[model samples]
Target chain A: MFGLRYLEDVVTLELDASKCTGCGNCIEVCPHAVFEIFEKKARIVDRDACMECGACAMNCAPGALSVDSGVGCASAVITGAVRGTEPTCGCSEDADCC
Target chain B: MNESTRNTGECCQGSSTQKPVEQAREQQECTCQPEEAPHWSDGSIDTPSGRILRVKTTLTPRDHLGTWMVHWGIRRMRYKITPGLYAVGSPTQQSPVFVTANYKMSFDRLRSQLWGRHAWILVLDTKGVNVWCSAGKGTFGSEELMRRIQAVRLEEIVSHRTLILPQLSATGVSAHIVRKGNGWRVVFGPVRSEDLPRYLDAGMKATPQMRCVRFTLANRLVLIPLECVEWFKYLVLASVVFLLLSGFGTGGYSLERIQDVGLRSVLMLLIAYLAGAAFSPALLPWIPGRAFSVKGAWIGLAAVVVLIAYGLPGPGVFDNWLEAGGWLLLVPAISSFLAMNFTGASTYTSLSGVRREMRVAVPSQITATAAGIVVWVVGRFM
Candidate 1:
């Protein structure tokens, strides 16, 4: 991230600490280093830095993590709003995304 | 470099003990046709699994050119390799299997980084998307990985059962499921293929730097081409609309007025576009705002200053103060909206953050643009 920060408190990423077995899978998969193991439990240390990529949730075996993840591009949002669909980069069927 | 490596090349050349008919049969067994060999692969290698294509560790001139073209958004979506298994150098049954997307750029980067090393390259069909993106869309998920593994008969080919996938691919792939499906342990490698050599040398362990993704100045700048290209069609339409609008004036629909004011408006818009798409991104970190729209509007404000200075009375660029005021609002609005669009290319933006920004930014942009156009029209009539 090298001094590049997005909007704070806007990411939907959340962790249910009671369910965390602290297998360190979230630390392994997160690109932003958003989670860290604290006393055998996963802690959201840098919550603001989370991009909500959902890698943690997917890899979390105990179902401790969850987030509303999707492509964060503006054009995708605009296109989805116009077309009445979920925000997509339009890379798959439409073939017009970056 | 060694005798075994030389033997691999010779065997692939069909100069060894294997018969021509047998070679043909092996080639036919692969998912890809012999004649349709991807530009990157040199020839096919006969393996216990099947006939897998052999790729060189170095990238060719054509590969470099193709990557450059894709950066400019030319044939980007179709720039893909035939998805299946491939061999780099003379990989043996014990060599590690590296998983990647079918996108040529992704394959090329992973292979080229292997320079002088041997590994099995298992390409997943992500419809030409890079690993991170396809993973986000679920093309690189557990189901696809399990399917590709079975299709290639990977268990029979490799002595080990570990699959080395790019760390970013974890977004879609659940390691536990892949383990549960067939006991093929999934090992997530470094975020970048550039770090492969170190990761491999360190016994498949990744340092913190290898896991974290960074968006330095170079990363931000390289995405500018696609961003600019995406706006091309819109630019043309906006220019035509402004041209038609410029024909209206106190003199009553003069073509001469259109040539003067229309050309100026187009130039202003062009500057605004570059300011938002290129300049703002280059200076993104230094820009004093968390929201992309605010950062873009600041740059747009700077553009307004430059345009006004250039449109001094002797230059005769603007007819009156009202026209200049309209431009001041219009230029920043366009720049702000365009800059907000860059969230897709950025590495660390969240969906919630983008949605929150759009809720406020989009409405403000529309209002500013509409007000600017109305005021400009009123000024023209006066």
Candidate 2:
């Protein structure tokens, strides 16, 4: 999965290693290989790879992971700003706005 | 293959004559016929549930064509596989059941990687979107998952009580609720479908590498075609408007006047498009700014320098230093606005970050462009 590796470091993904249960959920849920387990705890191996999708944090039962995740598109954010609503990519579960 | 099975497979094929959307609609209607239960083709064996089409794990020519069309933003809404249970190879009651979106590209990516393996694919209707995007929209949420499971009578078809879902879909699905409601365990798989084979082989355990998402240069490049195509109409309109406006400055509508100012303005616009939409994305990683608008402005500035060096727009196009400065400001501002559109496709941006960027960038872009136009008009007429 080669991507714009340099730009991804801007993602605000943070891992509270102290709260990790070492169940490896974050390691499994992250698509960017952002975390690695070391010494029975999860570590941020490649911080630059995080897409800020927040899959790891959602799957983490121990609440060891957190990130400010939402639609990342500029147009969506602008639309939200103009419309005065939470920014959405329009791919809501009930309607196919694509 | 049985007649019903063959017809079902034909429904999945790209129609040569009909519009893609019409064809998809017809296919969707076709699948609804109670007698024509969906089935697989290519040496697939018949099962009690339906025909399990034995399919190769690699992409076919049709699949390649579909991917190419999608890249160009052609009939993208029509590019979906019918939502239902599909079998890859010779799946049985004990085979693993994987859930995904009905977006044809996503389905192709998953099935293509599973060559020589047997599995049951349960595709949920996400209105032709891929899993990750649909998940964010909630189409690939727990409710849909549970609905598909029941609709397919999944409990009866597969003996196993576990369902494998993409890790990216976790945001929309509550694993606890699904387990509590259905007595089935939800196992989140790796981020990429390419890792499915390895994940399955390793007893459903994803390695650290498999979980990470990678947006390589190739991924960024593929998004460019669609961006250019979608924005092309606007680009053409902008060029025409600028050309007309350029003719209004100084001289009346004359062949010489049109050629000198009109053509030059249009040329500048084309350069803006190329710099903002195409070059900015291709040179994404190497660009100097974390913000996409800044990167686009840099590219636009570079283009302006080259244009001035070559004197391509003609010396009369800008009569004074103020007019020249106005062109410089306008070019990069247009470029910046266009480049900002890529934030949706980018891998690193977050909602908060994008909001913050837009709060500042959009206003600045609007002001720069407005001021540049005012300066140019003043320099030309006054």
Candidate 3:
């Protein structure tokens, strides 16, 4: 496993120890090695390694976990929002936008 | 477009969408697949390291250089060119030098647009990824740009200290840092290559529109496929599950009612995806709010309104009710998900902005989807 300090990108999750339940879910669910468990509570051992996928926070039961997670590609999000349908590729079966 | 030929051509090809590792894997497949580009003596480039780089593509007429039709065709089909640095023409001292990435399509685009222009293309080793993704990954950042400049000995090839970079690459590569590190100036050009000539002719000033990022309907529409493709697997599984459950609840283990699951899912999925990815982008300014999730939610509600008016049969129509229920939650949840995806795309969103949005939006999304699914089940049982 990459050391928790391996943050290659900015992360959204930060543990407010005052708020954390020490459930250790953030450390468990993080795809990036962004957190570590210390004192039965999760700590952000590496923020830069966080891709901000939000899995940890979503899986967090006590709401102690948080992140600004989502797909980062602008085009994908834009296309998805407008069509009221999944965004289609330029070659997606000849719809008007496609 | 025969299946085999398409397969051969496709594998031999590259995409900006693929990550570096994925691209590397695909590149390997290019040589291994049959009828792969036949430019080389057995249609493959076998490196000493046992890695395969499909360097050979079947020759095409000179209307464009070797195999560029495939390049252009892919660009047109996808509406997205691979990002990277490339060479349009060999340049010596006093010749213009352009920088890009190994995103084959982006390389092809810059060169193809240059047409008859003679320029040196400095291909930065973004590990064969496109310029934008490379930028996000820091491959297009100061260190990599500086490193690539050094590796290419670009200073030797051009008398000018200026290297033209794509406008979108500005986020990761700090121009000041690049200049300080490499003794070269970074000049950002237009977002599209066709504007390169105008940009250069105008002494490297990007027109207002060129600098502005557009989320036109066309742009949104083109990106829909990648979204759909990803959901394709989940879609299949979801539909199967929904159908089986619906059958048990409504028709006692039947296929006729099962197809409705697919239809409902397709419709709901499409509405939400389009609202978030396509409609939101196209109507961003008028989406009623600054927050992407809120904007997506607005669009999602509008979708519900539109579909309710257009597709629903009657008050008690069960299928219509299921669809409506499906969309009520699906649309908002999808919009939330799509909006969340926007964190990486927009220039304005900060880590805090994104984090705050997620804290509120995720639970709402889950609640909405759960509620909609429950409604569908209740309606079916009723």
Candidate 4:
């Protein structure tokens, strides 16, 4: 992550502090260490590092996390836009989806 | 239909005799081997659950070849192993059961790391996709894990209810749900299979470094082949089209002009492709942009400058200024689009970030390409 940072302030990740049970699931699920426990509440420490994979939101029992999660591939976005479907890693036989 | 086939059809038809259907399903799930392929495993072992396939800790020459071939997008989608339980070494009831996707690359990487160790590999049906991508698509979700566990009767085969899953699979698997619903605790493993030995020896606790994903130079380099392969056909087609188009001129169709100018255009395109797909990714960190398109454009511009200095398009061009001007805009646009495609392979790019970049970059690239083409065609006529 030191040299691989992407666009700043573009991640859709948001945390409703009141909904956090301080379960630390977000911290556990995040591959980027985007979350931290502060005063028994989940806080987004490195907001820009969040890839919005939806793992933290899915694993969070209290539903404290929310983000418009999807594959971060430009080709997928282009294909999905053309096909009028949700962004998908190309699943065609010839293309290695993802 | 045969007895098993008819019984399966009846099961799907909601037949009243459901017990046989359940038994048939269990029987199939237990022996997950395909009828035509026996090479899925190295050998077989007798276990309490059934006769489980035994896999080797070391990969074969064929496996290495297959890995290399897949990098070039050859037979990549079909590269899969049978999804079920496999034995590595001589695993016992107390042995660790690691779960993974059915992609042969994923399976091979995991098993190869387990040399001289006894372990049980529980392969999930992900339609040949790797763990991280399949997990992102829900193919490696909690339902699939629970279903596989029930189908294989894992409770009977293992003495423990713990499962070790790759940390990246957390995108689809809800550890809390797996534990709460079926009592099988999911312990997420390291982000890479190579770190598995250290993870197990540390009593299954992963350090922060193990959890984080890094796009190292080697990782970035390995993906370059696929990018080249993906664009190679298009590059050829575009070159041919430009060659034929170059024959048109104010005097008449001239083969000599086409040979000189069109051939030069092909070389420029190839250089642009390499700059975008090869150089841009290899020099990603040093490239001065958060957006991949911008990074590619910078490299493309540099490549174009080198070409111009080296006297591209030759001296006999209908108009040297027009031809060079068109190439200046065209090469960078082509490079930028190809570079943007790497967002899928990158580890840190968010969906929002990619979308934001594409929104601005794509339209600009399209405009540049259209303008460059117009200018280039005008130069050919002059």
Structural similarity to truth (TM-score) of each candidate: 0.90, 0.83, 0.58, 0.90
- Candidate 1 TM-score, C-alpha based: 0.90
The lDDT for every candidate, in the order shown, is 0.83, 0.72, 0.55, 0.82
Give chain A TM for each model in order: 0.90, 0.81, 0.64, 0.88
| Superposed model 1: Cα runs more than 4 Å off | A94-98, B1-36, B309-317
Real interface contacts reproduced by model 1, as a fraction: 0.55
Q: Candidate 4, residues A21-71: lDDT per residue as tens digits?
A: 998878877899998899999999999988878888878888888989878
In order, what fnat does every candidate score?
0.55, 0.39, 0.06, 0.48
Task: Go through the candidates in order and give each one's DockQ.
Answer: 0.43, 0.28, 0.05, 0.42
For model 2, report DockQ. Answer: 0.28
Local lDDT at B61 for model 4: 87
Best-to-worst order by DockQ is 1, 4, 2, 3
Question: Measured with DockQ on alpha carbons, how good is candidate 1?
Answer: 0.43
lDDT of 4 by residue, B111-166 (tens): 98999999899988776778888888787899878878876778988899999999
lDDT of 3 by residue, A14-66 (tens): 66777777865455334344577789777887675555545455445566766
- TM-score of model 2 relative to the true fold? 0.83
